[model samples]
Target: MTLVQRELVEFQDVLTPRAISQFLGTEAWALHSRRSFMETWVHDSGVGRSLEYVHIPTDRDAPDFSRRLQETASTLSRVYAISMGELAERVSAIRADLFFVRIARDSADGTIPLRQASGLIDSIEKMMKAAAIVTANPLAKGTGRTSERVRNFLDDDLRMGHTKRGSFIITIAARLHDDDIGHGADDPGAPEREGPAAANRVTRREGRADEPTIDFSRRVMTTLSRSLAVTRRHLDHSDDFVEFEEARESGMTAPIVEAIEEIATDSGGARVDMRFSWTSALPHEGLSEEPVIFTPTAIERAPRVIERFARSAGVPANTDVVGPVIGLSRDTRAAGEEEGDVIIQADVRGSVKKVGVTLSGNDYNWAIYAHRHRLPFTVSGILGKKSGRWWLLDDVEVDASFLIARQHDRIERLGGDAPEDPAAPVDV
Candidate 1:
């Protein structure tokens, strides 16, 4: 496809979300009248933050400097640049902490736990700063620039009022069919705008019960949580960029975001309705390029990876597949003391293989997690031709040892005793 032709083909096509929807087999990843709450403060980091890098002779750094620095050391809008999204993904892949969350919102029925949603605003802030440092330092070298201060909002700073005030309607759309980009047809969600009817817009299948339904707000929050966790893991465990290439397969090249809906805030915070659509198709690399790195700690503990499969009932070695993890089986200790297992929706190339693996009864710490309710993972190993299933055998890296970073330096995990909103749903 020619450059102009490709752009034209991609035009108005809400591709990625649709691709995501399609990948998810949903009608649309859409939410309606969902509320979003954010407290914005006039911190140097939060206020007037720019992806555009400029030279002060004294400084040059961007967590997500999206600019190519081709001519006159110019810059580009993060909304337009893929690098910022990539930077965000890289940080998220590590699943590090960017916020000290405070539980705030939930559904009246208590089904939607906004409190469970990972704090994203804080992640964005942290990543932006991190990107600044990474782009400049290259090797995790500390920037001696005193002009920068840790992104902090507490005590006396909170004493000063910083409340964002406003109300607006939003429509987030996605269309996937490989026309050009996950770039779905242009709708109001394209660029942040204002108005009333604008307050309410509609996609083809607006609120069709049969179309598809997903708790998008919760999904967003979950994504934020997972991203934070990955960052925390990477920062605490691995050394440098080695993690990126360690895995053989990657969806990192997939087009995740065509654009970003930059949140609006001047006062410490703002609340708005967040609507989502779970269409039929979306992209492979999530909506954000920030990847979720899966380092299998379970493999190290497994007694026999390939040999176990060899002994299984008519198992075939080296079957490649990519799909979501369905469920994790635990001991009858949890169920009825049944043997442990891991269920997977194994898409072997194009074939749909619903497979399950007997677990080692251990590996829980590094074994299971749900990405959007279904864990999307990839592995190449044995598949029983008869039973059509296999166990998670060993770590991907056969020889390399892994290390975990010191725990003291981590952003504290939200403890059970931590303060939660009194207004939040009751513990059921």
Candidate 2:
């Protein structure tokens, strides 16, 4: 068997002459000259400053096309005080929200353990999914089916860029829609315009729309930032998760905390820094321009927080939940005793979530029967979460009456009587 590795994307391959010209045009560069196969763009700083010129190849098929493109990129990098890779990314994702994650470790080299490297990528993806879910549905607990909008955004709009040197750096880009672009200031770093004129304009704009429009991309990042900030503060100051619970509206969920823990643990307790770079093309407001650093203490406390959040988001105690028996697991037990775990596809709140319940003796037998019959099972218990799963404790029993009624409903929905022969066992 042979393994083929994915080819890395290089700046020289992506940063073509046309991309350079478009980027330069946005930076106020003016066309200086044109030749048979090339064009010159000049950026003049007025007065005493020397004019900076970049040569762009008009013909990509020309022999010196690649060379001219590299030269143009180098000159632009120098002019912008950024690396060629950074310039290339800026040009490529002009309308995207950029996130940079750097994993710090004791190792001198930039390489990470193979296990941790895989974990890092998986964790980053989970973090983005959490953010996107919460942003679109503010009250989402992330225990249910994800919306199609979020799934589409993750599949189509989000992108992972090439990794860079210096401990391990991951770059993520989330492309913004055109309507999402016009909300923020053109200059991200510039101070908000002041005085009565700006104030009156803001007032007039506020009057135009009863509710301010939400930028999905910006909202996702903002929610993530707020939730992370809350987590860090909670770790720094208190042990109680009351404040953390309040942050649910800010996109703090079990998955987000778990993702942070994965990154922190993979880095071997070293700090992890996450930086945000909002596109200048659509400069967003209210996002923390400052980087969020996951300190050792915060990382250490993350597991506890994740547990608390999951438990908090779980179904309330002493409640009766009815759902189909989806799975059953039995292990060796003492003589004359029947003990096993049964998984119920219960509806929690408005979402269907799997609830794990342990039953013994008659209850266990009944669960097996329910599983065999493909019938909905009803159980009354306290629902809690552990190890990222929902568990039911105490009073775990099948409601015979509710089960019968649900089975009847299923048969009715089928528009006929169930066959006399037992239905084939459902694959859990």
Candidate 2 on 1-428: residue-level lDDT in tens? 11111111255444755445545544667666656577777887678989988787766568877666667776777788987666778775555667888987766777788867876877787778777887777777654567898888889888887676777888888876644332112222322332222211211235567544555776776777777777666665556444665666555677777677767765777898888877654445666768887788867777678657646656355767788888788857646677788888766543345678887766676677687877677787876554445678676655666445555576679786664532321111
Please, what are the lDDT tens digits per residue for candidate 1 over residues 1-428? 54333432332121222221112112211222211121111112234663322221111233222121211111211323443223222212111112222212333442222321222333233323333333333343112231232222111111111111122221111111122112211122332322222212222346683443322222333343333333324322555322322311211100010001112111122222221222212222333324333222321211232233234324354565456666666666666323466556654322233555554322232235322234354545555422212344433211101101111112135333422532111121
> Candidate 1: where is the Cα deviation over 4 Å?
10-12, 15-215, 218-224, 227-292, 296-428
- Give the TM-score comparing model 2 with the true structure, all chains together: 0.61
For all the candidates, what are their Cα RMSDs to the real structure?
25.0, 9.3
lDDT of each: 0.27, 0.66
lDDT of 2: 0.66
TM-scores for all predictions: 0.19, 0.61
Please list all clashing residue pairs in model 2, or write none if there are none. none
Model 1 lDDT on a 0 to 1 scale: 0.27
TM-score of 1: 0.19
lDDT of 2 at 262: 68
Q: Which ten residues in a row have the lowest lDDT in candidate 2?
A: 1-10
- Top lDDT: which candidate number? 2
